[model samples]
Target: MQEFKEREKQEQTISSPLSESLYENLRRIRTVFQTSHDVVIRELRIGEDKNIPIVIVYTDGLASSQSVSGFILDALLVHTPKVEGVHNPEKLFELMSTSILAGGEVKPLSDFEKLYLAVLAGETVVLLDGCAKALMVSTRGWKDRGVQEPTVQTVIRGPREAFSESLRTNTALVRRRVKDENLHCEQQAIGRITKTDIAVMYIEGIANEKIVKELFERLERIDTDGILESGYIEEFIQDSYLTPFPLTYNTERPDVVAGGLLEGRVAILVDGTPFALLVPVLFGQFFQSAEDYYQRSMIATAIRLLRYVCFFIALLAPSLYIAATTFHQEMLPTQLLISLASQREGIPFPAFVEALIMELTFEILREAGIRMPRPMGQAISIVGALVVGQAAVEAGFVSAAMVIVVSITAISTFVFPSYEMAIPIRVLRFLMMLLAASFGLFGITMGLLGMVLHLCSLRSFGAPYMAPFSPIRLAGQKDMIFRLPHWSLRKRPAMISKENPVRDATPAPAPPRPEGEQS
Candidate 1:
């Protein structure tokens, strides 16, 4: 009950007007921010006869000190402008807003809560002696990383730009790509204490309105004290909690977000995080890359097929190795079986144990490589791969066949376009290995069946996770498993966009006849 009261207090909307008396309003605001040392309250005497009293409230680190000092402080302090209407405080604030302050954005805030929130969020708020409303000036500034190449979603042929931590900059990156006027970005502030800004972006006509409404509703339901990153929003809004697979796809690439927006998908961009979340995510989209659209369809399609092939191999290879060598030796060829039997003769552990050792060792090394310093990480990954694999094989810690299988699985996991997709596969690989150890090929088959069933059952914001494959929407299948030529991809995924189906109505292209030939 105490927690509920606290939440109610935090979630209270700022609809009431500010206190009429300047002393009372200032006292109330200061009482709330009494513990905060970084907040600055500068009193100024502006307007004609220099009797008009005003106070500037802003947080120290969040706002640009230089802008406030140079533009606001200097303008009112030294170069004071005469007020035509001295008696009316409301008109004085209006006049000062228009002609007195010449720099940055200025918005009128009627509610004291809104004013204080804006002040805390880095905007300079100006309160006049008699006026009930305050002016919020744009002064947001903080040290942040500039636009850099996406470390995870890097592509060879596509644009190299990635999203930055700044919300406006990230949104601008998407806006620059999607020039359509119909593209809309709706903004909201979540987290009671942090008040993190989040934007829900989508194409007005193309994206499904029902999904957009649902997405916003879920966001509104998040009643946390703070949201540090996009991951928080993802966890709160994702459809299924039971599954490891991410229903929403997140990426640091702007071009990727723009492409999704064009395809009738909604994107959620969170402040302070480069990663942006895309809704109504599909399984096949995980295998696809940004580079696919940049290169020839044939090459892209071939690569897409390879990723899918690797997905299965990465998922089932080690399990199959354990099953075939342990339970079903007859499944292997005579010479291969003999070679495996010979290799296992000196080994102390069983086939499952052997494979488990190798996979865990590799995973540990891979993790170490990522967590360590970049230079050291690269060196460790290279040295560890060579030293560990060869040493394990030489020391008879694992069989040569098992090493090959584990290595192949690792390589296949790396082939996946998104790391988010690879993670679930990596986790499920162990379960499959356990199942195979118990029931061999039968166990493997059961594991696959369970995985497929879960996938079919999963829904990403009302859209089927395995769409164009499970429910078998024919229009959505054109770009699945294989990347049909752009011209051949006549319609968008029927599940995603029902109205904006056909993207290209033109027939396939053919070479023009010889110059002499006529129609």
Candidate 2:
């Protein structure tokens, strides 16, 4: 028994050296980054005679400089008198907790993994020689863009404040709207190299837990080196990698994110990006906006209907023109057909070729207008309209009717609230044009059918993308194509309502009239 005990003691001693060496090696490996602003090391002598040296290390950018200077540095170097026993890591942590100057907890550096995490969180670390643990001080300060009005999603009557680049700031913006305690935000660090912090927020009781779980699972599977923008994360986690249509919806407005959460959806907010991702998005969701809810129901409905009309115009105008002129001439009114034929009398190219030429030119000009500086953008648009429309007609390059159709189509595409949603329509416009030229109205019908079928097949987190239309949920029809009065919208969307059936407690009764009033 005595011999066994000695052998056990020797084994422990042998392992102790390796552990110590491992810790030392890790510390050295961390320093190799040689990032000047990061990896700051501070040496402190607590007392005049204690002879105890304290080394503080932290990534400069990740930590608050003011807090470190005013609290940790001021307290350790100037306020407290150095004592021999105060050199220990536990003692340091306890001292910090009690001292008003520190304002945060101090942890052991021997918890080196946590030390690295602390550095990432903008905390400073203090290392004491001959001590098993290191003292980590909270001091993280970084500058970020202030919340401002969303440039892209401007509203005439709604909250002007938009989400900022900071995840915490963005989440807080959302939290301000929803004061419910059930609103939960889960944080995860994504990107192997950038270590970007991504936050997933949703209402616990209202949001679909299964959908949220799937969203998180897919996010965890992303194995990228860096997430420089929200687009990077969006493209990584989207359901259909090949589709031009965006599977995930993104917005810069905090109200939109909050609204999605209320509708039992999960929102992903990425650090350093203003755009927030909303999951389980349907085709119709892209058409709706915060403005839609804020405006009068009648006006909102009219606008939504107009947008729906615009979508068709954008997709079918050019194609319909090509079909009517090239293959379906007999279907057009005699006078209209005669006018169109007269306009194209001198045109050298076929109806399809003329339409393609005008469309390509318009697309190029549109792209140029967007890419150019703001001051020059308006000028480009004006010049493009006058030169492309008027000049092409006079030159006999394209028919006047074709020019009108293309212009209307281009204008209609702009009505879509979501830019991502509009992009697929733009691509589909060309395909429909080709089909119409080849097979007339029948081809257009087939193309529309194919699109509908594709949309029906798409599942946004297991909910039918074309819900309340394809599956035909009558309960959700109130809010599908038009905005119904708030009081009349008794039931929530059936797709998400499985998780949250009761949107309101009871129907609000009409206000009572005066006693003298008669029906």
Best by lDDT: 1
Query: lDDT for each of the candidates?
Result: 0.88, 0.80
Candidate 1 backbone collisions, by pair: none
Q: What is the TM-score of each candidate against the true structure?
A: 0.94, 0.90
Off by over 4 Å in 1: 1-17, 78-80
How do the residues 311-369 of candidate 2 rate in per-residue lDDT, one tens digit apiece?
89999999998998888889999999888888889899999999999899989898898
Query: Residue 76 CA error for candidate 2 (Å)?
Result: 1.4
Candidate 1's residue-wise lDDT over 1-519, tens digit each? 999996566445344578768887788777667899999988777766778888899999999988898768888877766674568987778877887775578879999678878988889988888888888888888777889888989888988899989999999999999998999989999997899999999998899999999998999899999999999999999998999999999999999998898788999999999999999999999999999999998899899999999999999999999999889988889999898899888999998899899999999999999999999999998899889989988998888888889989999999998999999999999999999999999999999999999999999989999998989877676788888888898877888868676678888999989998888
Clashing pairs in 2: 46-82, 47-82, 62-122, 63-122, 63-140, 63-141, 64-139, 64-140, 64-141, 109-134
Q: Which regions of candidate 2 fall more than 4 Å away from where they truly are?
A: 1-30, 35-39, 48-50, 85-89, 97-101, 104-114, 509-511, 517-519
After superposition on all CA atoms, what RMSD does each candidate show versus the true structure? 2.5, 6.4
